[model samples]
Every structure is written in C-alpha cells, then in structure tokens.
Target: MSFWDDRYSRDEYVFGEAPNAFLAAQSHLLPKSGKALAIADGEGRNGVWLAEQGLDVLSLDASPVGLEKAKKLAAKRRVKLSTKLLDISDYDWPAERFDVVAGIFFQFAGPDLRDTIFAGMIETLKPGGLLILQGYGPRQLEYKTGGPGILENLYTEALLAEKFSALEIFHLGDRDGEVAEGSAHVGKSHLVDLVGRKAG
Candidate 1:
C-alpha cells in the first residue's frame, strides 16, 4: 500500500477529522452557495464543512481509505459531498472552474508536481474566485510536529507568490499557531497561510 493508503488504514486520522485551522478561520469568506473543490482532501472534513455551508462540494483524494472515511464523515455531518478516488497527478482538473478552491495541507513531492498542481489550481478557479491554502513552512522542521519531513515539500511565501502570480494576494504570511490535527499535528506550529483571489 502507498504511504497515504497506509496512513489512512489506521483507525485515527493523521490530520484529525476537523478542518484545518486556517480553513475554519476563513469560513466568513466562503460563498454561501456555489461550487467548491477541495483538492487532496484527505478525509473530507473541509469539503463536508463547505457542503454544510450550502456549497456543492467535490472532494478529491488519492486514497480509497481516506475517501471512505470522508464519506462516513460527510454522512455524520448530514451533508452531501462527492468523492473521487484518483491520483491528483493523473486526474483531469475541471475545465469550467469553481467559485472556491481549497488546498489545505496538500503538499507535493517536488517542484515539477508542485508547479503543475498550482497551475491546475489557478485554472480550476472561476474568474474572481477565491483560493484558500495553508501548509507547513520551512520553520516547521525545527518543531518536527507534523507535516511531511521533506524540506522540499514545505511551502514558503516567496514560492506562493511565484505560484499564484495571476491572483490578487489578499493575505500571505508565515505565523505560529496552535494546530490540533489528531495526534500527528499538535501544539504550536509554524505554518504559511495564503488567501488569494483569481483575476476576473
């Protein structure tokens, strides 16, 4: 089994069942009703929350085990969410685009995949759409609290600026915050949070 599959096979969620703190804090910005895509949504917590907010949500993940849990979590929340089990690298992104595109803690292997994924993200957003993303920063290595140990996978403000050049950056910075994502991510952690709007 792949690393993600093995991770999901466990009884507990590696990143917790709750939505990412950055996502939860940005709830006010989400559209009340519109199409949303949660990319690399591990167990659908963020996607399900978007559905609860009345948005039509499509949760995409590579792990069947994770998607299965996402379904259950959606059901528990009494919300409807569509789940797709396919490698994000192989899957075709939607052509039309979405009102909101969320990428919470979706780290990639290297620059090639990261560039492609970020480009796909930009293309997937409708004109004037919102993009919410949060990930561990380079400083996270010192904490060793959570996230991929690989430094290459971590995000930086400079990298985000380059990636979303077309978008209007509303907010982008690295800060320390309390992260409670199951046992894997806990306590004060350094992270980068970005909120950008696609140019209309």
Candidate 2:
C-alpha cells in the first residue's frame, strides 16, 4: 500500500468528513452548476461537498484506499462523486475543462512538483473559471498542526502569486488562525488562501 493508502486505512477520516473551512467559505464564488475538480481529495470530503453544491465533481487522489472511502462517503451523502487515481507528477491535466479547481491542504509536493501541479490547476480551468487553494504557509512549520514538515512543501504568498499568475487573482492572503478540519488538522495554523479567475 502507498503512504496515503496506509494513512487512510484507519476507521476514521484522518482529515475529518467535513470540507475545508476555506473551501466552504468560498461557496458563493462557485457556479450554480458546473464541473469542479478536487485535487488530492482524501476520503472525498471536499469533493463530496462540491457535489452537494450542485457541481459535477471529480476527486483525484493517488491512493486507491482513499478513493474507495471517498466513494462510500459520496453514497452516504447521497451525492454523486467521480473519483480518479492519479499522481499529479504525471497527470495530463485536461485543458479548459472545469469551472472550478480546488486544492485545499495539498502541500505534500515539493518545489518542482508543486510547480507542475500548480500549472496544471491553472490549465484545467475553463474560461472565467475559479481557482481556489488553501495551504499551510511557511510558518506552519512552527505550528506543526498538519501538512508536510518540509519548509519547501509549505506555501508562501509570493510563491502562490508567482505560480498562479496566469489568473486574475482577486483574493490572496496569509494569516494564523484556528483550523478544525478533522483529527489531522485541528489547532492553530499558519495558512494561505488564494482565489483567482481565468480570463473569460
């Protein structure tokens, strides 16, 4: 089993069954009905939430175990969720295919890999589509609430601005706050959030 597979084998959702607070807060920005992509969506929390919001959601993760749990969660929630097993390193991100792309707490990638994934997130967006992302900021190393321990795996305002520069960034900021997602992320954390839109 892969790292994520092992991590998700637990009886409980490590990150909890609720959507990320930041993503939930951005609900108003989502289209009433459209395609959405949830990256690294473990146990389908965010993807399921997106489906509940009337969007055709595709949840992508590298762990089969996690994907299975995601499907089960979707059924329990009575919402449709499509899941795919994909490694972001080699993913062929479809161009202009989704109305929204969300990457919440996906800070496991290092600099090089993150660059590829970030670019793909931008590429997959439909014109005027929204790109939402929230991740641990550099200071997260101090909080150690959740996310990778490596500093390079954490996000910074400048890094995000440069990475998703193709889009018209409307909201971008970093701050310390309490994050209660699940057992994994429950405490004060340094976080950065970005919301941008592709040119129509």
Candidate 3:
C-alpha cells in the first residue's frame, strides 16, 4: 500500500468530513447545473458537497481505501457521486469538459506532472467554465503544519496565474486561514486560493 493508502486505512478521515475552506468560500460561484470534477478527492468531502449542491460530480483518487470511504460518505450524505480509482497522472482527463472543476489541497510531484495536470484541468473545462483550486503556498513550509514536505509541491499565485494564463482570474490571493481537516491538517494554514473562468 502507498503512504496515502496507509494513512487512509485508519478509521477516521484524515481531512475531516467537512468541505474545504476555499471550496466553501467559493460555493456561490458554482452553477446549479452541469458536470463537476474533483481531483484527488481523498474522502469525498468536497465532491459530496458539490453533489449536494446539485451538480453531477465525479470524484477521483489514487487510494482505494480513501475511495471506499468516499463512497460511504456519499451514501451518508444521501448524494450520488461517481468515484474513480485512478492515478491522477495516468488517467485520461476527459476531453469533453465540465462546467466546473475543483482541486482542493491536491498536490503533485513536480513541474512535468504539474504542467500536465494543470493543462488537463483546463482541457476538461468547457469554454466559460470555472476552476476552483487551493493549495499550500511556499510559506506553508515555514509553518510546517501540514501538506507535502517537498517545497516543489507547494504553489504560488504567480505560478498559477502563469499556468492558467488562458483563463481570467476572478480571484487569487495568498493568506492564512483556520483549517481543520481531521488530524492531518489543522490550525492556521498558509495557502494560495484561485478562482478563474475560462475565456470564451
């Protein structure tokens, strides 16, 4: 089993059962219809929440253990969500696109995969679709409260702006906020949050 699998094998959800902070904050931006995709959705918290909002949601994750928990969470919430067990790097991102794409606390290895993933995210969004994403900032290393240990995995607002240059950023900022995602992520956290709309 991988580190994430082992981490999720435990009874408790590592990231809690609540929606991500950035996701919650940006909830008003999601359209009432059309499909949505959640990448690296560990326990379905955010995806299920999106489903509850009436969007058809597809939650993808690498850990089977986490995916199982995600399914259970979906059932508990009484929302229908499709869960996929696939590596974020390997899976063929849909070319058709979606109305909304959410990536909260999803980390990648390096620039190679990062570029591919970011491009895939853009490709999966229909013209005029929205992209909501949040991740640990470079300052997160100084805090060391949570997130990947590797500095390269962390994000910066400038990097995101450059990556999604085709999209118009509605909101982008770096700030500290209270984050309680189970035991793994808690307390004040430094993060970069972005909300962008695809150019028509």
Candidate 4:
C-alpha cells in the first residue's frame, strides 16, 4: 500500500464528506447540468456533491483505497459517481471532453508535470468550458495545516494567470482562512482559488 492508501485505510475521510469551501462557494457558477471532472478527488466529497447537483461526474484519483471509500460515500449520499484510478503524469487526457473540470487542492510535484497537467486540463475542456481550481499558497509552508511541503507545488495568482492565460479568468486570488476539513485538514491555511472559462 502507498502512503495515501495507508492514510485512507483508516475509518475517516481525511478531507471530510462535504465539498471544498472554494468549490462550494462557487457552485452557483457551474452549469446546471453537464459532464464534470474532479481531479484527485478522494472520498468522493466534491465529485459526489456535483453528482447531487445533477452533473454526471467522474472522480479520478490515484489511491484505490480512497476511491473505494469514495464509492461508499456516493452510495451513502444516494448519488452516482464514476471513478477512475489514474496518475496525472501518465493519464491519457483526451481532447475537449468535458464541460467542467475542478482541481481542488490538487498538488503537483514540480514544474514539468505541473505544466503537462495544466495543459491537459485546458485541453480536456471544450471551448467555453469552466475550470475551477484551488491549492495551497506559498505562505502555506508557514502554517503547515495541510498541503505540499515543497514551495514548488504551492500556487500564486501570477502562476494561475500565466498558466491559464488562454482562458478568460473570472476569479483568481489568494486568501487566508480556517479550513475545517475533517481530521486531516483543520486549521488556518493560505490558499489560491482560480475560476475561468475557455475562450471560444
């Protein structure tokens, strides 16, 4: 078992069963119904919430243990969630395949893979599709509440602006606040949230 598998083998959902705060706050902006992709979604929180809102959602993560728990969470919520086990580095990202793509606190190891992942995310969306993402900010290292220990994986407004320049940015900013996401992420943290639409 891997590190995440070991962590998820325990009885609790590390990030709670509710959707991410940023995603929840921006839910009104999502289409009423469409195909949605949740990247690195563990325990089905965000993906399942999208399903509940009537979107056909796919929850992709690298951890089988976590995905299995996600299945149970979907069942408990009486929603259908499609799941796929994938590592973004090798994921065969298809072109223009989705109406919405969400990546909440999905950390990347470095710039190389991060670039590919960012490119893939843009490629995966149809023109005018929505993209919502959130991640730890550079200052997160000072807090250590949750997120990558490496500064390279952290985010900044400039990074998002540059990376997703092809998209029409709707919201891109950083904030410091308390994140009460179960036992794993509970404390004040700094994070960046990004929202945009692919230009037609």
Candidate 5:
C-alpha cells in the first residue's frame, strides 16, 4: 500500500466527509446538470455533493483505499458515483469530454508536473466548460496547516493565469484564513481559488 492508501485506510475520512467550503460556495457556478469530473477526489466528499446537485459525476483518484471509502460515502449518500483509479501523470484526458472539471485541494506536483496536469485538465474540458479549482498557495508553507509544503507544489494567481491562459477566468483570488476541512486541513492556511471557463 502507498502513502495515500495508508492515510485513508483509517475508519475516519482523512479530509472529513463534508465538501470543501470553497467548492460548496462555488457550486452555483456549475451547470444545473451536466457531466462532471472530479480529479483526485479523495474519499468523494465533493463528488457525492455534486451528484446530490444532479450532476453525473465521475471521480478519479490514485488511491484505491481512498476510492473505496469514497464508494462507501456515495452509498451512504444514496447517490451514484463513478470512480476511476488513475494517475494524472498518465491520464488520457480526451479533448472536450466534460462540461465541468473540479480539482479542489487536489494539486500536488512540481512545476513540470503541474503544467502537464493543468494542460490536460484544460484540454479535457468542453468548450465553455467550467473548471473549478482550489489549492494551497505558495504562502501556505508559512502557515503549514495543510498541503504539500513546497513552493513547487503550491499555486498563485499568476501561475493559474499563465497555465490556463486559454480559459476565460471568472474568479481568482488568494486568501489566508481558517479552513478546517478535517483533521488533515486544520487551522489557518493560505489558499487560492479559481473558476474559469474554456473559451468557446
């Protein structure tokens, strides 16, 4: 078992069962009902919530244990969830395949890997598709509340702009505040929120 598998093997959900506040707040921006993709969706909190909102959701995670827990959560919610085990590094994200793609607190890569993943996400989205993402900002290292704890694995509005330049950015901001999502993400932290649509 890998590190993430071990982390999720506990009976408790490492990141809590509630959806990320940022993702929940931005839910209104999504299409009322459409095909949605939740990348790196650990334990399926956001995916299940999306399903509750009437979206056809497919959750892709690298951790089988985590995805199993996600499955259980989906069952508890009485919602249908499609899960795929994949590593983003080799994920075959076809072009214009989804109406929405969400990556909440999901980015954890160095610059090179991030560029590839970001590009793949942008490519996989349908024209005018929404991309909702939230992640730790470079300043997160100072707070050390959550995240990969390296600048290379962090984000900034400038980086998002550069990375998803093909998309029309609707919202992008950085803030430091309390984001107690669960035991893993507790206390104050630096975060970046992004909402953008692929150019039609």
Candidate 6:
C-alpha cells in the first residue's frame, strides 16, 4: 500500500471532517455556482465543504484509500463530490475549466514538482477565478504540529508570489497560529495563506 493509503487506513479521518479554516474563510470570494478543484483533498474535508457551498467539486489525491473515505464523507454530508486518483507530478491538468482551485495544506511536493502544480493550478482557472492556497511556513518545522519535515517543502511569501505571479494576488502572508483541523493537524503552527485571482 502507498504511504498515504497506509496513513488513512485507520477508522478516523487523519485531518478531521471539517474544511480547512483558511479555505472556509474565503466564502465571500467563492462563485455562486461553478466547478472547483480541491488538490490533495485527502479525506474530502475541504472538497465536501465546497460541495456544501453549492459548487461542483472534484477532489483529487494520490491515495485511493483517502478517496474512498472522501466519497463516504460526501455521501454522509449529502453532497456530490467527485474524486480522482492523481499523482500530481504527471497529471495532465485541464485548461481554464474551474472557477475555484483550493490547495489547502498540500505541501508534499518539493520545489520542482511544486512549480509544476502551481502553474497548472493557474492554467486550470477560468478568467477571474479564485485561487485559495494554504501551507506550512518554515516555522512549522519548529512548531512540530503538522506538515512536511523538509524546509524546501514549506512556503514563504516570496516563494508564493514568485510562483503564482501570473495571478492577481490580493492577500499573501504567513503567521503563527493555532491549527485545530484534526488529530493529524493540531496545536501551534506556522501557516501561510494566499488568495489570488486569475485575470479576466
């Protein structure tokens, strides 16, 4: 079994069944109704929440075990969530198809793969589409709450600005905060958030 598959084989959702706080706070920016892409959606917390908000959501992840759980969560929430098994590194991203793309706490990729995924996220957005992203900052290593141990996998304001330069970034910053997502992500944390819009 894959690493993530093993991680998710347990009965409980590793990251809980609630949407990421950062993503949930962007409700005002969400489109009334359109397609949304939830990257590395794990157990469908964020994706199912998006579906609850009346959007067509596609939850993509590298773990079938996680995707299966996501499907179950959608069923429980009475929302429609489509899931796809994707490795992210080699997936063919669609062009200008989604109204919103959320990548909350998806910090598994190193710089090279990150660049590819970030670019594809931009490419997949329709004009004026919203891009919501959140990740652990360098300080996360110190916090030891959650996220990759690799410093290179963490995000900085400058890195996000440079990678998503094509988008019209309105909010980008990092700060120390309490992250109580689930058993997997809980306690003091360093978080980075970015909200950008693709040009119309």
What TM-scores do the predictions have?
Answer: 0.95, 0.98, 0.97, 0.97, 0.97, 0.99
Clash list (residue pairs), candidate 3: none
lDDT of 1 at 94: 74
lDDT of 6 by residue, 4-58 (tens): 9999999999999999998999999999899999999999999999999999999
User: Which residue ranges in model 4 land beyond 4 Å of their true spot?
Assistant: none
Instruction: Give stretches of model 2 more than 4 Å off.
Output: none
- How do the residues 64-116 of candidate 5 rate in per-residue lDDT, one tens digit apiece? 99999999999999999999998878799989999999998875678887788
Error of 3 at 9 (Å): 0.7
Look at candidate 4 and tell me the lDDT of residue 84. 97
The CA-based lDDT of model 2 is what? 0.93
Per-residue C-alpha lDDT of model 2 across residues 10-59, encoded as one tens digit per residue: 98998999999999999899999999999999899999999999999999
How would you encode candidate 3's per-residue C-alpha lDDT over 1-200 as one tens digit per residue?
A: 89989999999989999999779888788898889999999988999999999999999999999999999999999999999999899979887578999999887557789889899999999888999999998878777789887888888989999998888998998998778888999887888988999886
Clashes of each: 0, 0, 0, 0, 0, 0
**lDDT per model, in order?**
0.87, 0.93, 0.89, 0.89, 0.89, 0.94
In model 2, which range of ten residues has the least summed lDDT? 83-92
Task: Write candidate 4's Cα lDDT for 1-200 as tens digits.
Answer: 88888989989898999999889888788889889999889788999998988899999999999999999999999999999998868787789888899988878558788888889899999888999999999889999999978999889999999999999998998899899998878898998889999987
- Candidate 1's clash total is 0
Q: lDDT at 161 for candidate 2? A: 94
Better of 5 and 6 by lDDT: 6
Q: Estimate the lDDT of model 1.
A: 0.87
**Cα error, candidate 6, residue 170 (Å):** 1.1
